[model samples]
Target: MIRITFPDGSVREYEAGVTGFQIAESISPALARSVVSCGVNGETVELNRPIEADARIALYKFDDEQGKHTFWHTSAHLLAEALQELYPGIQFGFGPAVENGFFYDVLLPNGEMIKEGDFKKIEDKMIELARKNEVVVRQEISKADCLAQFGAAGQTYKCEHIEQDLADGSITTYTQGNFTDLCKGPHLVSTGDIKAIKLTAIAGAFWRGDATKDQMQRLYGISFPKKKMLDEYLLMLEEAKKRDHRKIGKEMELFMFSERVGKGLPIWLPKGTDLRIRLQDMLRKIQKTFGYQEVITPHIGSKNLYVTSGHYAHYGKDSFQPIHTPEEDEEYMLKPMNCPHHCEVFAWKPRSYKDLPFRCAEFGTVYRYEKSGELHGFTRVRSFTQDDAHIFCRQDQVKDEFLRVLSIIQTVFTIFGFGEDQVEFQISLRDPEDKEKYIGSDEVWASAEQAIIDACKEKGIKARCELGEAAFYGPKLDCMVKDAIGRRWQLGTIQVDYNLPERFNLEYTAEDNSKRRPVMIHRAPFGSLERFTAVLIEHTAGHFPLWLAPEQVAILPISEKYNSYALEVANYFDTVGVRATVDNRNEKIGRKIRDNELKRVPYMVIVGEKEAAEGTVAMRQQGGGDQAVMPKEAFAERILGEVAEMLKATNLKPEN
Candidate 1:
């Protein structure tokens, strides 16, 4: 018998060679039935794989992330099986689970084509194969044998992948029915578990995401354990289509992309630019209240700057090629990160312990080279500005600074009306054994990591811990927020770093007259203006709050006859700091209201004959309702009052 450790710190005796399924069965039959995968000593693996020694184990149900990944992974194999049956000589490349679904890249035989119309037939065939309940078998094979199997089967793509990527003893193959592919899998027990299947899309993709490689058909799909669940998922997908920022951005005339300028660069229109500025001003006011000093940095830096900061080693290849200067040795790179530049600012002058905590903030625009395929409207743009700040403080001040940053994030979320459930807190730490992946000494990394964890604990914040998810320099406190449609997006982050100061040789004189390195805190409540705007647009469905709306009020005249009165109301609103526009277009009163409503203006005022005569304005809310006629002065006060209250309610006062 060997000792088995469970997550709850309970130990039990189990016979050697007992499978994870058997161990789960010993706990409860229900668990055995629901478990799709198991974590053995921190590694996720197939449930039926035998455990020869004592190990820490956690059984995973379909609701768990690992379990869902396992389920979708098996579904990918199931897709390949269906493809093999329907289209003979179909060669498969990479097939892996994605964020919402799974996709398999494949090269079709000569004269064969797969289109959107073929999705139904393919889904039907997948369901048929799933009903077979075929057991998925995993096998370890030598590289020679692996290449031989795929080569003999005329799966050139598979053969090429194995030849190029797999090592001799590291080859593994998973077989379900007649379909066998090279994979290292923690798959579900059988295809029977996949009850509902969807073939969502078919697109062209290059093998291994290489533009130089042959283009293949990428089939995207998703699966669920129950039909009702699949139905709900499909409904969510439909809702997502409606909220897609690209569609809404164009419809609202917020921003656009151009082939003449560049593919991934976004050009913000007048309305979008105005809205972004409002957001920046709000953040600026909050930062000022918290004693943050604002600064500006250049858009490009010497390649050596990144090299010293260690960003070059990690992101250099993915970044745009360096720009050569008049001198051959002098080269510059588009700023991929702001931290390195901030490091330079810290090093420019000598400092004493009195100047220990330096808080510098910037709305710095940076550039990155994102693959064309990965670029989406504003979310994944190549050029964007980060509401970035770097706090250089003494070691003891790390926790307090971190808590202050978290407070800022909470304040912003509250102002945006995000409830606790709509946002998740996570502490991302480095993998303990992977020293090569991160900078800093073990002691420094440990201290920085613990500071973040301890800070969260002290603040009564419950955060999930993710290992091996840290930045190359430090651990992070990340906020993953869900939009109105319940789609999660990583929005804000605060990272603790002890490495950069050491690399830059930044020093501040201590009371003992000894030089000490200052700890760095990197934070961004709005990671990027463009990406946050995209998320906010989707979350509110373009109905911006009164304070943040680009055009808060639309003054709609009954006709050309009341255009003068409309201008009068607009002027009154302008004096009270209300952003209002007069719609004196050649259109009817009803048509004007309808058109302005689609613009998502928070409020609309109708200055008609009665209002113009009475010196009052009729107020209408964006979605609906006539909110009574009020004096023009009274309407301005109402708008101004509501905005002031919103800011007051959400502002965070720094702790003394």
Candidate 2:
């Protein structure tokens, strides 16, 4: 008999070679029907895979992320099969599951081609194949035999992929009906399990993501077990497309990119600059209250700086090349990170224990050489500003400092209207077996890891732990947030580093009169201003919160006749610190309102003959409809009150 331990810590004795499906059936019929995959020990595997030894297992259903990944992986295979049937002699490349769905890269035979219009036919063929309910069979074969089979079948792509990527001892293939593909998989039992399918788009991609390789057709798709779920997914996708930040940014004239200026470099228009400054001012105030001392750092640093910090070894080749001095051997680089400069700052002054836990903050703009193909608008940019801070604290103070940082993150999220369920915290720790890769001693690493774990527990943060995900220097706590469209984006990060201090030989005089290294905590509440702004734009659909809006209120005149009244109202708003603009163009009131609404201004204040005579404005709130009419003074007071409330809610301190 073999013992299997379940996630709930319950153990059951079973015969050797008992399959996960059989085990699920013994527990409950519902579990047997719903469980799509199982995690044996720590690795996810098919539910049908037989267990031969004592192990721990967790059954996963469609609701779990892992289960969804397995389901989509199988869906990709089914897609490949349908493509082969639709276009005979199509050679296949990689087809892996993505965060939302799956995609397949293939080379069509001869002169055959695929376009967006071809999606329906392929989707229909996939549905037909799925209805057959053919079982997906997995087989392990020798490298020689696998090569021979694909070579005979004239699948040069598959043959090249196997020869170049797969080792002789680790080779497997999955066959379903008349289609077979090389894969390392945990697929669903059969094709019939995929009840619904949607082929989203087709694009050109380089083979295996190598620019020098042959370009292949990339097909994107999604699948679900029920038609209703597929419908809901499509609906969400539609909403997402409408909320795409790139589109909204263009429509609102907040930011733009010029091919002449360069790709991936975002140019902040006047309105976007106003909004960014406001965001920075808000963060500056918050950091002040949190006992952070703000400082400025250069956009570029000496190349040797990164060499000592270990960034050059990791990102050197991929980063922009160094700039050499005219007559000196010295070279400088556009700073890819702000931590190394901050490290130099700490080492500048000798410190005592009383001066421990020194927090340095900076809104530092850094540059990196992101590949042109990987560039997106604002989100993946070549240059961006980081709301960065580093805390140099005594070893015993790590937990307390982490808790304080956690509070800052929580405050920022709450101010932005992100709820508890909309965000998740990930605790990343170093890999134990490869201690040499990290800088800190085992004792310091253990202390830092435990401190972070305990701090999360004390703060009531329900975080998931991931090993081998830590920064090479230390452990970290990463904040992953879901935007309005349900897409997850990594926003904030807090990393505990014992490595930098050691490398820099940083020390503070302890009470015992001994010099000891202070642990460093690297944190960024807004990971990068560029990326955060992009996410914020998408999340709110360009209707920003009143305090963050570039133009919180637009004074729209009824016509040219009421332009003076509109200017008066705008002046009043400006006096009260509300970002307000007057729309005095020679157009109808309706046209002005529609234009401002399209610009996503939060409030629309209308001034006409009636309002002008009475010295009042008709207020229209975005998405909230009309608010009550009020006199200019009353309106300014109301706006100020709302702004105060927002700042209070965000725990933003007054700028010092």
Candidate 3:
């Protein structure tokens, strides 16, 4: 008998070769019936796949994320099977499960194409195949055999991928019914688990995301274990479309992108700029209370800067090319990261151990050469500013600094009205097998990971630990926040780094009067202002909080006579620190209200005959209407009070 340990630390004696399904059957009938997949020592695998030795295991059901991934992965195979039946000689590219659903790229034989109309037919075919209850199968095979099979079938894309990416000893395939594809997978037991299917869209995609490669028809799809879930998802999709930032941003006159200016470069209009600056000021205030010193960094840096930081080796090719000089061979590159420059700042001064936990923050703008096809408005912009900060601390101080950062993040979320349930944390650690992808030794990684885990536990912050998700330098704690529509976004992150200080040869004199390497904590409560703003826009549907709204109030003159009063109200509110604007157009009150409402400004103050004479204005909220007819001073006081409450800091200080 071998010892199998469960996630809760309960161990059981199981016969060797007992499969995950068998183990589940031993525990409970409901678990055996509901479990779709199992994690064996952190590696997800098919439930029926046998275990040869003792391992830690966790069973997953359809409701869990891992279970959804497994379900979708099987659904992708079912899609391939349906397409194989419908379109013979169709060569397949990568087909993988994405966050929302799945997509499979295929080269239709004889220059054939897939269009919108084809979605239904394919979706119907998938449902029919799922009803057949075909048992999905996994097989391990030699790379030589994999290449031979695909080549024989004229699956040129698969053959080329296998030849270039896969090694002989480490390859696997998943087969369901008439379809077989190369995939390293943890698929559901059978196709029958997929009770609902939808082929969302069809697009042209170059194979393997290489723009120069042959273009293939990419079919996007989603599946659910229940039809009701699919219906709910469809409803959310409609709501999401209505709240899409691109459409709302255009309507609100917040931000825009121009093809002539270049793709993936967002131009913040006046309103958007105002909102972003307000956000920056709020963060700065909180940082100041937390004992953070803000700094300024350049938009470009010497190539050697990244070389010393070890980022060039991993990301140089993806960055904009080095800027060449006319005078000599000295080359500079558009800064892809702000951390390296901050590292230089740390290296600028010799410090004693008393100066440990030195924190520096920057609203630093960085650039990346984002492919045009991959860019998506502000969320995936080429140029964006990060609310970045780095804390240089001693080993024992790491947890305290991490908790402080967490508290600051929590305080911000609380101010924005995000509750405990809406925010989740992820402990991202490096992949043990792919050591080359990460820097630092195993000991360093283990220590960093443990530090994060311990900090979260001490703070009672429930976090999901994910393997192979760390930064190249170290492990990180990522904040996964759910927006108003219940869609999860990775909004904030704090990472621990032991590698950078070593790379830069940075040290501080310890109490023993010996030089010691200082540990680094990289943090960004708002990962990028552009992406956060995009999320905020969609989250509130452009109806911003009063304090963060670019124009908190709009003064609408009822007639030509009231324009003077409107300007006076605006100027008075400006003095009281409420951002307001006078709508001096000669439009009627009704028309003005409608236009101002579309702009999503929080409050509208109507200046008419009674209000101008009485030194008061009629106040109306954008969605909530006709609050009160109050004096201009009272309105300004109310607005200013609300702003003060929202911008309140947490006093997030360090614990020595």
lDDT of 3 by residue, 1-656 (tens): 99999987899989899988999999999889889999998889999898999999999998777888999988888888888989998989988999889989888889888888888889999999999999888899998889888888889888889989999899998888878899999998778889999999888888878898899988889999889999999999999999999998998898989889988889999988888987888888789888999999999999999999998998987799899997988889999999999998888989889998899999999999987777997899899999999999999999999999999888878767678999999999998999999999999999999999999999999887888999999999999888887899889999999999999999999999999999999999989999998888889998887767888889999899988888888888777677889998988889999999888988999888999999998999888675899999998888777666554433322110
Best model number under TM-score: 3
Off by over 4 Å in 3: 645-656
Expressed as tens digits, the lDDT of each residue in 447-507 for candidate 2 is: 8888889999899988866667888888999998998878899999999999888888899
Tell me model 2's lDDT, rounded to 2 decimals.
0.88
For candidate 2, give the lDDT of residue 623.
65
Cα-based lDDT at residue 125, candidate 2? 93
| Order of the predicted models by TM-score, top scorer first | 3, 1, 2
Give the Cα error of residue 106 in candidate 2, in Å.
Answer: 1.3
lDDT of 1 by residue, 1-656 (tens): 98899977899999999888999999999888889999887678998998999898888998877788999999998898999899998888889977777999988899588998988888999999999999999999999898888889998888888878888998889999998888899898789989999999888898888899999999999999999989998998898888787887776678889999999988989988888888888898889988899889999999999999999998887788789998677999999999999988888999899997899999999899888888888999889999999999998889898999998998888888888988889899998878799988889888988999999989988886767889999999999888888888888999999999999999999999999999999999989999999999989888887777888899999888999999988887877688899999989889988888778888999988999999999999988965889998998888888887776677632110
Alpha carbon lDDT at 514, candidate 2? 98
- RMSD to true structure for each model, in Å: 2.6, 2.7, 2.6
Q: TM-scores of the models, in the given order?
A: 0.95, 0.92, 0.97
Worst 10 residues of 3 by lDDT: 647-656
